[model samples]
Target: MAREIDQAHLLEYTGEFSFDHKLILEFIKTAKPDYDHTDPKTWPLITSAYLNKWLIKPYSGVLMLPPFIAYERSLVDLCVADREDGNVELVREDGVKTVRSRFHHHFPFIYNHNGHKRKFEYMHADHYTSWVFGVTGKVPATRTKGKDTPSASADPFDEILELIQDAQHAHKTDGATSLRAELESAHKDLDESKKRVVAAEAQQKLLDKELTHERRRAEGLVQSKKALKQDLQKAFRGEMEQHTITQKQLERVNRELADTNKLWREATNETIAAEARSKKLEKTLKDRDKDLQVSREQAATLQEQMVKIRNELKKGMEDGGQKRQADSNASSSQKKKVKIQQ
Candidate 1:
């Protein structure tokens, strides 16, 4: 349930109605120089005079003095409770405000004090976390004897009853002369009582409507908070799922990069080995060409020596045939001359 405002408690709790805490404490000490404010038992009794003296007339014509609050912290005039001007306003989460007026419980009540009927608000003091509502005034009331005002021992209710009996006796003794005036007074009092009752009933109906509206506002606030909590929970879950997927993709990419680096290292080693074998083959081909040129020069020298030996043999045979023919002709001539002479 949304709480209805307790005007007295709100007055004590809010600084708007009370004087400065330090100033109130100073006033308490000034009221009783020797009284121990720390000890509740020694604290001076509060009275209307002290409360009255504490309030200076406010610059605003509406200055309400403290005596307006009765000893019970209630409005001194209960019949005027319905006529108060207090209001309440509530602010919603969307920045809209609902205003209500004519709250009556506790008041800047009007009461008679200091020989003048003055407007008064509540007055309270604080001492080390404990509040001293000028509920106990700065001064105590002293009764002096021989006055029309009630004595210190008088019971006000008993006095009012006694005065009523005295009035009845006087009217009876005065006879027909006072009867008409007495009847008129009774009729006036009855009319005022009826007016007060009608006002009280109208105020009660207004209070009932305000209470229903406050209850609905409280229920709406609870539902809005529950819906906001659910939205935050869903958003957090989606972010966590997306974070998990990204982490898995990063791990897969790292593994693929490692495999590519391993293949690059293996290919580089094979290329180095192939280059070393090609250099060795080129050195062997150069050595083989030098050996083939030396073998061709030795074969050409042996062929030339064979051709010179054939030419020398043919010339020696021709010269020997010619010398043999000459020797045979000389022998034939000598034999023919000998035959002729015979």
Candidate 2:
């Protein structure tokens, strides 16, 4: 995922300041030699008055003063100068002397010390100067006059020339700083854009590889579809040939069935003719048997008549014989009588 840009301004101090009240009291005492340090309330009042006089009053035009004072390890937090103006001189020894006088005269309880003591000198001047330069972007001015009092009437042309030089330098430095910041920002954007472009290119490569695989799969499917179509056409042709052969066989079977029916009809007609002839033959045989019985009865009656005729002839013959015998006897008797007479 892409990251969101951080649009917030960079913070100058990333951590909190470690405030040292003891250090602040010491700083106040340095400004006023006899400033009371015993009273618990006195510490806050004196520190408030000192900060108001030196730090707050000078920069009041540009920024608001914080309610509390804090310092870093190196006391850098004590420096709060504006970059646009060179007014840090107001927070130096000159400002401290003014605050001390207020405490000595008006608030004596806070500053109960002798008046004849030597004037107090503010310490950490170099640190304060360096801090001012860092904040204002202005170079520190080198002191050329040491213990020499300047004349009352100074050269106004020289002062005007120095002011012009300072203004020109400040302008050039500001322009350079702005240009540097813009260049750094551009470099950061370029690096982020390069990273995004690389990521997009990798993603495009993966998509291309996936597309190639899909194309191959589609081609394979097309080839398989074509093969299946050819097999289906071959199967359809074979089925058509088989159907034609089956139709021819069915026609031959129909012809055979018709021939068998014709033969069956002829056989049935012959059987009917044979049955009529056998019935006629049986009737003729019955008439011939009746005629044969009549012929046998006539033969028996002729045999009985032949037997009666033979018996009558035999009786006649016997009667004739008897008559002859009687005659012969009479003749023999006549003959015997004639012989005896002789």
Candidate 3:
């Protein structure tokens, strides 16, 4: 039977399921399922079934049943047949029993159920369909379900199947309407992105032009700086030449001043010698004047002596002549007396 095959697959899958004793215990506590509460070995089977039936089954689409639900139905059928032997020992090729431990490689994005790697393929299929509708601006065809309404006395399994079909039909109809609106909005966003890119390119061109203008200005400034530096060098050379000329002129003036000072000293010495000679000549002239005055006094005394001698000689001659005349008269008188006596 088909049920028997499904059960066999379930058993094999459970045996390979990595045992996580702690995770299973926590799942059992939260879910509070109708299973053995004390035994930790039975936790994986109970928790896996719970997750498949409640979390994964209801939202599954009509076209593709989720892997979790398919696995769970097999487990359920096995339990109904013989619930006692559900827990089986899982072993590796090395003959070492797989202990209760968490699956290390399990993650949110990767769905590794019963040795099959599905990824996030069917999980968000409706969301992907809606996105396609929004982009294309098209509505997908609706999937119709059975119109027969079940009576109150209908089998419980039949009623449950009918409700699941109705729910899938409603989900498809709502998704198509919402997707159309999303597609129109996505088209407008694409137009806005294109406009932004064009504006950015225009702005980039303006920036490049400004950069070129600045480079030209920088070159002009460099030329001006070089010219100014050359002018400064020329001015500095002129100032140095002027300083050399001024130093030479000052040396010439100093030599002239020394020559003038020497001439003035020589002239002063000559004037002093001439004044000494003039004083000596004036003393000689005063001595000569005193000698001439003594000569004139001696000549005047000699003239007075000569005049006195001449007056004495003239007086002596007059006395002598008078005496001679008197003598002659006496002799004549004596001779006359003798003649009278004889």
lDDT for each residue of candidate 1 in 146-241, tens digit (9 for 90 to 100)? 112211342232332333344444432222224334433433443333433344344444444433433443454445545555565575566567
Instruction: Give each prediction's root-mean-square deviation over alpha carbons.
Output: 66.3, 81.6, 78.9
- What are the lDDT figures for the candidates, one per model? 0.36, 0.35, 0.35
Q: Quantify how close model 1 is to the true structure by its C-alpha RMSD in Å.
A: 66.3
Query: Candidate 2: what lDDT?
Result: 0.35
Off by over 4 Å in 3: 1-259, 331-342
lDDT of 3 by residue, 1-342 (tens): 011111122211222221244554444445544333222112223234544445323321111121111233333333223111111122433453322111111210122222233332222323222322322333333233222221224223233233334434544233333333443343344333343334333333433433343344345444554565556557656656777647676676556556545544533443443344335445544543444344344444433443433343334334445666788888999999999999
TM-score of each: 0.25, 0.23, 0.24
Error of 2 at 180 (Å): 99
Instruction: Give model 2 RMSD, 1 decimal.
Output: 81.6
Model 1, residue 169: what's the lDDT?
49
Question: On a 0 to 100 scale, what is the lDDT of residue 248 in model 2?
Answer: 75
Q: Rank the candidates by TM-score, best first.
A: 1, 3, 2
Off by over 4 Å in 1: 1-185, 245-342
